[model samples]
Target: MRHVLTALCLVLLTSAPPASAQDFPSIGSQYVDFGASMAAVGQMNNVMGAAVRNRRSDRVDSPRAAATTRYRPSPTVSARVRTQFADFIARADPAHSEGLRKFVQQNDLLGAWEQHVAGDGLRRGDVADAMTAYWVQNWQIANKVAFASRAQVQSVRAQVAGALAGSPGFARLGDAARQELAETFMLNFIAQGSAFSDAAARRDAGATRRLSDAAAARFRKDMNLDLRALRLTEAGLIG
Candidate 1:
């Protein structure tokens, strides 16, 4: 499936006419700025303080420390939450989930949610219900954007590419370069979405690392580009 998607992207990249700066339309500059802001927030979240890290280690590593800590959702309940969330996503955005399922699995999500509930002191059932509601609300908004029309999706993609192309670091790149980078961004977007979902469902560092390594390998094999070189953020593709 990864190979198939890569092949399709390659064909699209080769067959499509070179995009002029004018070819990319502006959706809105504010949206682009918002994307940058969101990226910064994500970066901040990634840098955990030493105190917080130690506290988390105590809770996770020491049985005596954990006994005194708050109750957390069990792995079984976490699995249920993930299955429910995936079902909702698959139903709400079948077209998108069709491709997403290849990278993310229920087990991946189970780990992420378990960690979330453990950190937040949330019940698994409650979290599952809350997530279902959250996605249902967002689904309406998403439908109006990409899901509603191919033209909108294309327009948004163009806007994103154009924004990157105009950036100082990427400005020197030609249209082909911009296009290639944009495609890479899109692929990373999909992969990260899956990874984030899994991470959210369960917070296993080893599992997350394995997922990242797998994705990097796929990017290298399929795109002939190092994933690290892209410097993609967790929320980079949200824009």
Candidate 2:
């Protein structure tokens, strides 16, 4: 439970050298052109068709405010979508933490999923080593979707995490079969977690829950497959 998202962020910030903020917004080039164009117009109309005195030509855009993204994501994004909820996971006992560590290495789970699946040191599959990459990519997509709104992501993920944290030692069977099944369940949860929060995204969310009932039937099949895979493959106790 390493909080990989925060770790990733700190890595990004610390990896690159810091730059001064003022170096940007290199003076308003757009507004200056507009104001200059208006001045060139000889006609200054008034209520009586008379030339009216004008204020300072410096009625330009704010010098301080700079351009932001066209579609800015929320600043609390990390809390929402980042898989690195490792801090909460790490809060367990040392024995549990050690178990979680084995789980992390076996599944190759990023620090975030480590937080999501607070296991008791279960390792990933001994077989199917290559396909493990699929789980990682799947995890990335799930995190990206959750990043849409952290509160929502946290809401659902918190439920599952609380389940695992509250009821530990669920992974009694430490075998390749269980490892594979656990991976399937974990990735499916990440996907469904985002779908739960994204009303629009639920249309294709595989699991048709309350928030995303648009194509519940279609996603229902997917959810079934995912759960079935987990239960059959990993021995999950999901009813």
Best by lDDT: 1
For each candidate, give its TM-score against the true structure.
0.22, 0.22
The models' CA-based lDDT, in order, is: 0.28, 0.25
lDDT of 1 by residue, 32-60 (tens): 11112233212221221111222311122
The number of residue pairs in model 2 that clash at the backbone is: 11
lDDT of 2 at 115: 41
Instruction: List clashing residue pairs in candidate 1.
Output: 111-201, 111-202, 111-203, 112-199, 112-200, 112-201, 112-202, 113-200, 113-201, 113-202
Which of the numbered candidates is closest to the native, going by highest TM-score? 1
Mark the 10 consecutive residues where model 1 has the least summed lDDT: 21-30
What lDDT score goes with residue 102 in model 1? 28
